[model samples]
Target: MITLKFKKFNIEAYKPGKSRVKKLRKVIKLSANESALGLSPKVKRLISNKKLILDKYPDGKSKDLRKAISKTYNCNFEKIICGAGSDEVIQMICQLFLNPKDEVVLPEYSFLMYRIYSKVVGAKVVFSKEINFKISIKEILKKVNKKTKIVFIANPNNPTGTYLTKKEVLELRKKLNKNILLVIDDAYAEYMKNSDYSSGLNLFKNKDNVFILRTFSKIFGLASLRVGWGYGSKKIIDRLNLIKPPFNVNRIAQLAAVEALKDKKFVNRSIKHNFFYANKIKKFLEKYNIFSNTVSANFLFLNFEKCRYSSNFFYQKLKSKGIILRSTKDGYHINNRLRLTIGSSKENLKFMNTVKGIFD
Candidate 1:
């Protein structure tokens, strides 16, 4: 037999939140951290109006969407570069900055994509230590070296739902080497209503090394359309635009994104729902002694490391009840943790009752 030869990079593929449960009639999927409210009806109505344009090639530059986003966020449009999602934009950044044996620094239990993308380009992945699920900038500084090319910080980090304040982030920038690129991934920024938390977008204005990433997938509820964009210095934005494929964002997605940005009412509703229900769920689980850290994002990360039941036990029990949640063991590298998305009011109530039954 002839030997088959293929060059495969050494890296773990990004594991998305678990979904697709079969044989469950009333399955409430709270695994992906997706918006329970979903896309606004106004977006659907606008998309429906644009049915005639589906036959044509989309605007390659995504000019309209960029303008809309810039207006909504009150940022400079020249610094904007859109992509299929934050994932693709991050891939582009890695390919541009990383070489074989180069290094990327990130916190432990952070978003997996940063590590996976860095490794895909043959770059070394370095993990910084965390304190009680919060990223320690001191630990991150210790990990950075001459080989480090990029630093990825997920504000309101996933699987933990904790955040660093603006002052803390600025201190990180001051301490890092000027040559290294700093990427701020703010996928959950919209869900957060706190004044103390900042997306670090201002860094893009003054710092040539800073890049701020935002997504329409989370608060805009356009996960299916996959619209993500980044803000950086003009030079960096120009480089990314050069490498970004023409028509990377489809016409439909672009249109929907513009309308989604304009619908302030919808965003307000989603924020309210997330806060009210996330707190409600956390309080309800208190009787079980299942505690979650204060979360600014749209999900609650319940720590079951010392609970009456193992994480796997609670997962299987909920799965059997037609309820689904995200476990952190396999993908997130955290044990005895479950991430529960703040679903609609009805779904949240159902979840509370269903979970309470397990203790009974």
Candidate 2:
């Protein structure tokens, strides 16, 4: 048998929860930050009509989808590139920009994909310290060096639900070297309606060194479809396109994403539901002395301070009750914090009631 010398990377320390629910058991899944409202009806219709085309190969150019995305954003078509998901785009970024000895900078409690992708390209990973589970700009600035090649920022950051204001981001960008690539991951941008907060697209337009990464996973409810795109200068996109595999995006995903983009009604409804239920959850938690920041995203970062059990213990308890939530401890070092995705009013109520019984 032929064997390669590449050893598997042990990056993400995922803790598998034991499932207590048996077949036919009803359970609420609020662990992953998925759009609980479900996918767009337009996507469903498109997928149904395109089922017969699966036998054929996908369009290598992804021209129509690119056009749709560019038209929606009012950007150049050449500057937009789609991938299987934003995760794939992250991997492609590492492959394109990182060298064996180059260093990558990210926040300590940020997304795990940044570190994983950096390591895949043999780049050294440097982490900035977390202040209340939020990335400190000062810490990031201190870590920057001549050897650093790329910096990743997740706005309305995952797991923490904390985001930097537009002013803060622009100030940070000013401090960084123009040579270093700054990636702003805006996976939850659609849910944010703050006037002070930008999706990083403004930075992309103003600075050639910056790029914005977006996803259909959260707001568009296309997580299962694996559709994501990135925007940057035409020069940067051209370089990325050189290494991107032909037909990187499949047919169904391209069609579904196009339809999902036009489903403004579904998008608005999902955002409204997220905003309403997130506030409800926050209010419910506040009565018990547990507090979270007022985030502009679909999820809430629940703190376990003054709770009877540790975060892991509480996680297990919640899991035993058929309630699943995302915990940040193993690789993230965010102890006593749980990231809860905002679900429907009923789902949110169920989660709140379950927590009330355990904590009260």
Candidate 3:
């Protein structure tokens, strides 16, 4: 018998939100924070084009997509690096900066990919405490030391809809060690209409130590395409390009992302729709004593502590009705809470009706 030796990691694998229910052929899924409106009409048209060639490999550098992104965001094209998703960008950053025993700091509850990718590179994951489910700059500062290599944050953070103010985020960047890289994920930025908030790309476009991650998944309604891009100093982007997988993004995904960026009308409609529905749902949930954070992102972080029923009870009730929501217990470990993704008009109506039935 031959024995094989390999590196072992104790990291907990990432579990995506549930999408299926037993004994149901179809279900209204509000578990994942996906785009409620689905893909842009332009993208749908592009995908349906019969003239597109599939035999040739996609451009390794994703030049056309980068150009579209540059035009949309008013950023330098040379500084952008495309990826399969922002998840891939996180992994590359970890590989480039983390060494065995190096420390990476992030909020106690954030996008799980930050900690997962950091751990894969043999780095120690240090979680900074969040106050009232909001990322605390002071707590993060307290955790930073000479060993800290990178800090990751998602504005309008995931699982919890709380966000740091623009002033607060700027202050955090200023106070951090100059040598430490700050990676900010702006996955839900398009949905945010808060006056006090700003996307990472807008705030840190010229900063060398700050890298911003943007995705087509959330607001652009291209989750299945797996297209994301990173913006940083040209020096870092040039280096990242070296390790980036050749043809990481498929041809159709690149084309779709480009078309998605060009359709400003669609983006605006989605934003308006998200805000209107999120506010309506938030108020409705409050009547039942199911409190949530202020409206900032596309989803609401529902707290069931003050509600008449337990989170588990509500979850099971909705599941039996073929309505799925993300329970904070699975991986997030946030007891008595749920993360509700704002769905389409039909799906949201179904969810609310199902909840009403449960309560009545």
For candidate 1, what is the TM-score?
0.97
Q: What are the Cα lDDT values of the candidates? A: 0.88, 0.84, 0.93
- Cα deviation at 349, candidate 3, in Å, is 0.9
Each model's Cα RMSD: 1.4, 2.2, 0.8
Q: Number of clashing pairs, model 3?
A: 0
Task: Score every model by TM-score.
Answer: 0.97, 0.94, 0.99
Steric clash pairs (candidate 2): none
Best by lDDT: 3
For model 3, what is the error of residue 124's alpha carbon versus the real structure, in angstroms, after optimal superposition?
0.4
Give the winner by lDDT: 1 or 3.
3
Minimal lDDT window, size 10, model 2? 15-24
Model 1: lowest-lDDT 10 consecutive positions: 198-207
Evaluated with TM-score, which candidate comes out highest?
3
Against the true structure, candidate 1 has what lDDT? 0.88
Candidate 3 TM-score versus the reference: 0.99
